[model samples]
Target: MKIGRIETFYVPPRWLFVRVESDDGAVGWGEASLEGHAEAVDGAFEALRDRFIGHDPRRIEDIWQVSYRGGFYRGGPVLMSALAGLEQSLWDLKGKVVGLPAWEMLGGRVRDKIRAYAWIGGDRPSEIADAAKVRRDQGFSAVKMNATAELDWIGTPRLFDEVVKRVEAAQATGMDVGLDFHGRVHRPMAKQLAKVLEPLGLLFIEEPLLSENPDGLRQIAELTSTPIALGERLFSRWDFKPFFEMGAVDIIQPDLSHAGGILECRKIAAMAETYDIAVAPHCPLGPLALASCLQLAACTPNVAIQEMSLGIHYNVGHDLLEFCSDQQVLTPEDGYLRIPQGPGLGITIDEDAVREAHKERHRWRNPVWRHSDGSFAEW
Candidate 1:
């Protein structure tokens, strides 16, 4: 029952998977993929291993507390992500030991399935109409796409017509569209963009302005009735509290792997529930991360929709199900992902495939974009 070893595998398409083993032969898996910074997150595990080795694996919360508070310097992407992976593995271990799914341990499920969404257009979106149709054919009722690419600080209103056109094209396919400004829009543009896109009845506008500018976000929220979804960058409940308090956001999209793991996100969801906000986790990573998100969705009532990485543009050579043994557990049906009934995170990892893929670990980095004037733009 004591934690024996902790190992991290850098897998394909930019993912870091952690494997935790107990002295008594229990094994648990978690993902700590921090997109472009997998190595930093992987490096963070060095301290986690030092702290958690020989400790009780079943003490999930204690491990989390120590990992976070004991570090003295905590709550950033790298440290929290590393802690998140370890925390998820501990839950996986404890769930398997008890012969119950993680959700069952987390007060059972509130829904049998959650509505799921897929990414339509690539980072620099184009031809979204066709992509939306493809997603509809794939049984997804909703799709998200970048609203614009590398926008200038203060562009003309005409720049948004194409955005409206793309959204119209997707909505033409009878699919709900969520336009992600991707924090590429500054305040001047965000207000205009949010005002213009308000008529489309979007599912949400994600990161119209980055979380750093809460005042800007609040202003955009006031400008439009569209559900302002953010928190992909905000890592914890402390980070998310102000948005809820200020009425700045309608939906919180905490990334399970980047935020603190399952329990932490569940707590965040509970916090959002008080504000009557919805939860739609941001998961553009691989299987383990998606499975971790599903676990949260299974138990939390506030979770409205789920985002999956299946066929997302970032999954270059390897897709979401590459290293998963039972893809059906994570697959979408009728535009919803069924609650995983299996113990732990509910999907089995193909360990051999993971180990094999680790040999050729990917050095994936998000594309860097520049404005027409050569100033750096958010990607």
Candidate 2:
């Protein structure tokens, strides 16, 4: 069927959803939320619609190639994220027409359920022990928290004692803790923090330094045994190749929405598998984004754990399940989400809720943080 129309919705708490329709009345949905840059990603769709309106919706790979190669300047967050949503919706539409789930078409099921981890402490972590206890009571065995609020270039060793104490408190609740540096730490402090936190037995340390600093990452990886998890920012397999080649990263956390969609990440995961690196798709958006992540986890063997945004700080008025019609598809049971078996992405959206929410279109932006001296800091 020919692609008849493409529609987009700006849902609350910062999410962008795409709906694709075929000439003969087939429909599919996907998320292209780039968090703070939703407008840029939405603007990207103008070019996509101009290129692929009358094209065959079933030829997903062909569409993807044309979308990428046809555009001379491509492969940034905005372009790739827009293509990711379109590609995901094409797969969803094809799967629905054929009466099969996205995973079955990819390969087959590798596991019945994939373990899920949720966010506990807020950006500037506090009361982590109690937060960990709450997550434990909710049946989550693991939780991720920010390592520090906003760090300067170089801090004293005493700056890390509180960080260590927070992790220890979380661990005391019988939970695995993943400390997220959030790319806020500079290389100097990242090295020191990695060294100090190595003894805590953390599940992983995310973005020890931003992926842009590969040399710094390699240095930090050599200094500590803690797994260096990154790639929430890197948008393509080409972007992730250097880390794999350098043996700098132990775990790759590609966000399905950000890193070119489901199939691209599957390829990236396969590349990581050759390096013996684990996969943990980064997903902190809404339901559609989480469903896309689940589809990837269902077929990919290297995926270690899934990062979900159930009660994350971003979802202020709207939570994960608020717009989801079939909540079971995205809900965690005992810290793991079952592989969705229904057609396409396997989760249904509440169209009414989405349409209503779109009317109010949230202009969500991440907070900008500055150090005590008025210099810019990564937030």
Candidate 3:
């Protein structure tokens, strides 16, 4: 079917959803947002929509090429995210026509259900422990939280004590706690934090420092045996080349929507597997994106676990599964969510819920933090 029109909505709690309608009745959905910047992503989609207006919605790879290589100055959060959404939408349309789920179309399932983790709050040790217990009670075997609220290049010993206490509280539940540095700590602090958390046992340390400096990443990697998982900020597979070649990272966390569409992320996952690095697709977004992640995880040999924001810290107005019609389809029983077995991206959007929530779309931006001396601090 030929592409008829592309529509977008900047939905609540910082998400942008795109709907691609074909000449026939086929429709596909995709989520492309980097927490903030929903409007920019929408503009990116609008600029690229003309290329697919009359093209076959089934030719996802060709459209991806046209949208990607089509722009010599390409591959940023806005463009790749936009292209990623369009590509996912096309795949959804194709899968629906063939009457198969995205994963099955991508060469069937590898595991029964991919293991997923919940996110616990950062900074508060007591609160984190209580949160871990709740998640464990709800059957989640793992939870991820920020290692620290904020940190300087070298913070106080009190901060380190607080970090250790948080880790201790989480470990009390006997559930693996993945500490996310959120790129808040520089290498100096990241190295020290890794050493401290090692005693408590960690699932992985996410973005210990930023992924910007690969050499610095190696420094953090050598300092601690805790698995270093990075690359949520990276937009393309090429961006991950140095990180992989360095052989420092034990796990690569590529967001399916940000890195590329399903096929591209699958290829990236395969590359990580060759490096003996595990894949845990980073998705703090919606169900369509989460479904795409699961599809890639299904065929990927090294996907250790998936990250889903069920009751995450940022769900002020919207949540995972609320935007979709088939919320029950994403039912997480005993910690793992069953893969969506229907055609296309598997889950269907509740247009009504989406439109209603879309009406109250939020202009969400991450808060900026500063140190006591009025110097900028990472948040």
Instruction: Give candidate 1's whole-model lDDT.
Output: 0.90
Residue 293, candidate 1: Cα error in Å is 0.8
TM, every model: 0.97, 0.97, 0.96
After TM-score superposition, what is the CA distance of residue 237 in candidate 1 from its true location, in Å?
1.2
Ranking by lDDT: 1, 2, 3
The residue-by-residue lDDT of candidate 2 on 8-51, one tens digit each, is: 99998999999999999999999999989999999999999999
| Winner by lDDT between candidate 3 and candidate 2 | 2
Q: Identify the runs in model 1 with alpha carbons over 4 angstroms from their true place.
A: 122-126
Q: lDDT of all the models against the reference?
A: 0.90, 0.89, 0.81
lDDT measured at residue 320 in model 3 versus the true structure, 0 to 100: 80
* Clashes within 3 Å, all models in order: 0, 0, 1
Model 2 bad stretches (over 4 Å)? 122-126
lDDT of 3 by residue, 211-243 (tens): 877888898889888889988888888888788
